[model samples]
Target chain A: MTQLSIDQIQAGDELPTLSVDVTPTTVVLGALASRDWRPMHHDKDFAVNRNGTRDIFLNTPNQAAWFERYVTDWTGATGRLGKMQFRMRDSVFPGDTMVIRGKVTNVSTDDSGCAWADLDLAMTVNDKITTSCKARVAVPSGSGDNPWKRRGSDWQPNGPGNSNAKANGS
Target chain B: MIEIPNEVGDWIGQPRYEEDTEFDVERGYIHTTCSSVENGNPLFWDDKVANELTDGPIAPPTMLSVWFRPHHWAPGRKKQAQPLQIHFDLKEKLGLPEAIMTDNTMTFGEPVRPGDRLKTRQILRSVSEPKTTKLGQGRFWEIEVEYTNQRGEMVGIESYTGFGYRRGA
Candidate 1:
């Protein structure tokens, strides 16, 4: 895997664009993986009749996970995810081709010497932005060990910790 | 005509998850999820590439909420009640038959690995006043789900927001 150091990354850098040919199978796969059995995500009848939606739509968590994969795919395994906030504007139905595009908007370093990049991403289909993604991701500092290992090496099961996107450190 | 229940405040800060502790995050499932999104990234499926970060491959950071789901065969699975849903009567009182997702924010805690047992709890964070929008008279509901591994390490947090609108215009 190619590791991108902080110095090598700069603001205004355009990340690769990904195009997805969404289908009923992809919609179901995402819902099944997330364990979301909401009829709106599976049962077409329930979605149209009961929920008043056109068809089975992608759940919010499933879309968030897709954005998460997009960022990490560029940052590699060493990339530590700090925070992500995205808004779903419209529903994404099966048989829609979603084109995802993103760009590095800003870069900064925390007091701990970890480099963080802020990105703006969007999912577009039929010339409409269905979801808008804004995120801050931790990346390699170009020197020393990866920040996550240096900070959170100990994995405790009983310890009370939060992984919410609101907090700076997980 | 919809308002948050008077007693709903009491349920905040409570553990929101049901009884199951084991996570179903396996490589096969992860691959399917990644593929479904059209992401053929190596880290999500390539053990050799991911092994460099940890002893084994890890699930996607955004996939945190995926692990806290209830099983299919469980009773009342069709209407699986989440923590806040079980404790607070917000939706029922709203009389809203339709739910629309508006926003989401997630924080990554520890790296979720294969075979990791996750313990989750949902806490009611806050609810907004009934406001008028194009959809109808609705209030925004937000809740936080804190997840920890079996070893007690914080895995991650996911907060979901939605608008429950009246059944008909």
Candidate 2:
């Protein structure tokens, strides 16, 4: 896997678009893997009749996993996620094509010397956004710097220069 | 018109439930999750590659809650564990027939690895006033879950918001 160095990232960088044909299996497997046994996520009859939805839909944790995969795929194996948050406006159902896209909002090294990148991502199905995300990830400063190796005071997820700080400030 | 019971307010800002995962973080579960998402990040698959960063192959940060989810059935256990008790409580208390999650935020801490047991504490943060929306009439509520490893180190936190409402009041 090609690791993304912090220097190569910019405030306006666009990640490669990811589109997938969401099927029933896609929704069910994701729910199962996340250990979400909620009937709304796997039982179509329950979702449609009981939950008042069209069909079974992706669970919250499942959507979170997709967001993590999308961000990590771009940052590569070494990238470490500090924080991820999203708002779900609608449900993702089977047979809809889900598209995920992201843009870098900022890049900077923190007081502890940890390189970080802030991202804005969205998940859309059939041209309508189902979820939107904001994420903070730590990327390597260079070939020799691994953000994953940072520990103790070195890895301050809520400190200055991180997304949590921005969220708090807002 | 919907009315949130006075007792609902008492649930806010309180630790609702504290429970441990049914099983430890396992490698097979991680692999299954990766396959489901089609995530090929080597850190979740290759131990050597992950050891370069942390102690060993690490579970994906998104899988924080998966470890805390209770099993569907266990021998000698008469009642099933409800990991999300607050959600159900609000539904019953408010007389809402249906519910949907509106948003979620997760802050990650220590990397979760294989063989690690995790515990979670659920806390109700806030509940909104009754409001009308395209979906229906309901109130929005937020809950937070803090996850810790066997060593008592913080692993992550999930702040989740959901709407409980009547289908067509």
Candidate 3:
């Protein structure tokens, strides 16, 4: 997979849309993989009768995996996640088509020299947003620069002007 | 609006529980997780591709919490500890029947690879006053969970916020 360098990205860049036809198996497997044994995510009767949802729905970590996959698929293997925050506005039940779309909000290098991209992303079902996400990812500043290799003080996820602090109001 | 008792509010800033995962991060588990999402990222499946990035194939960063999820049944254990105990505690303390997560933020530190064992610490961060929403009358609360590898290296932090309410209240 070809990795995108910082130079190749700019604010306002839109990522290719990703769409998935969610099914009962999709929901159950996601919950199973995450080790989430919550009945609402797997047991349809428990979900509809007890939880009062239309059907078994995707759990939080399941949705999180989806968002991470959507971003990394675009950034390629070299891309490393620094921070990801998302708000769930509604449930994504089986039979719904979840479409993910993203836009680059900003791209900048921190004082530590870690190049970063801030993205605004959303997962929509049938044109209605189920979750909205903001992500901070590290991309190569130039050829051969690997963000994953950075550690200790070099990687500051909550550094100044970083979206994490702003999102948490800290 | 339902009143959040002072005792419930006091949970804020208190570290709830710290527990180690039941098993080590396994390559097969990673494969199943990737398959569940239909994620084709080579880093998760291809050892060569992963070795280029880290020591070996790494678990997806989003799977940070999956490691600590309490098993449904253990041979000797009569009752399992509920996952996210603080959330359930709040629900019971406040007497809310329904709960839903509103938002979540995760920050990654180290790459979680096969054989790495993880531990997590949950802390209550904040709680909001009861308010009315379309769903019902509820309050919002935030909890932060810190994940660390067996080597004591930081893995990630998950800041989760949820709402607990009485249906149609």
User: What is the lDDT for A121 in model 1?
Assistant: 92
lDDT of each model, Cα atoms only?
Answer: 0.72, 0.86, 0.87
Writing each residue's lDDT as its tens digit, candidate 3 over A1-170 gives 76998999999999999999999999999999999998999999999977778999999999999999999998998888889899999899999999999999999998878898999999999899999999989988897789888777677776565534222212
Residue A145, model 1, lDDT: 51
Best by lDDT: 3
Candidate order by decreasing TM-score: 3, 2, 1
Task: Tell me each candidate's TM-score.
Answer: 0.86, 0.94, 0.95
Model 3 iRMSD vs. native: 4.4
Error of 3 at B119 (Å): 1.6
Alpha carbon deviation, residue A47, candidate 2 (Å): 1.5
lDDT of 1: 0.72
**Candidate 2, B17-97: lDDT as tens digits:** 788888989999999999988999988888788887777888999998888888888899898766677888888888887
Report the candidate with higher TM-score, 1 versus 3.
3
Q: Report the lDDT of model 2 for residue B91.
A: 82
- Candidate 2: misplaced stretches above 4 Å? A159-170, B1-3
TM-score of 1: 0.86
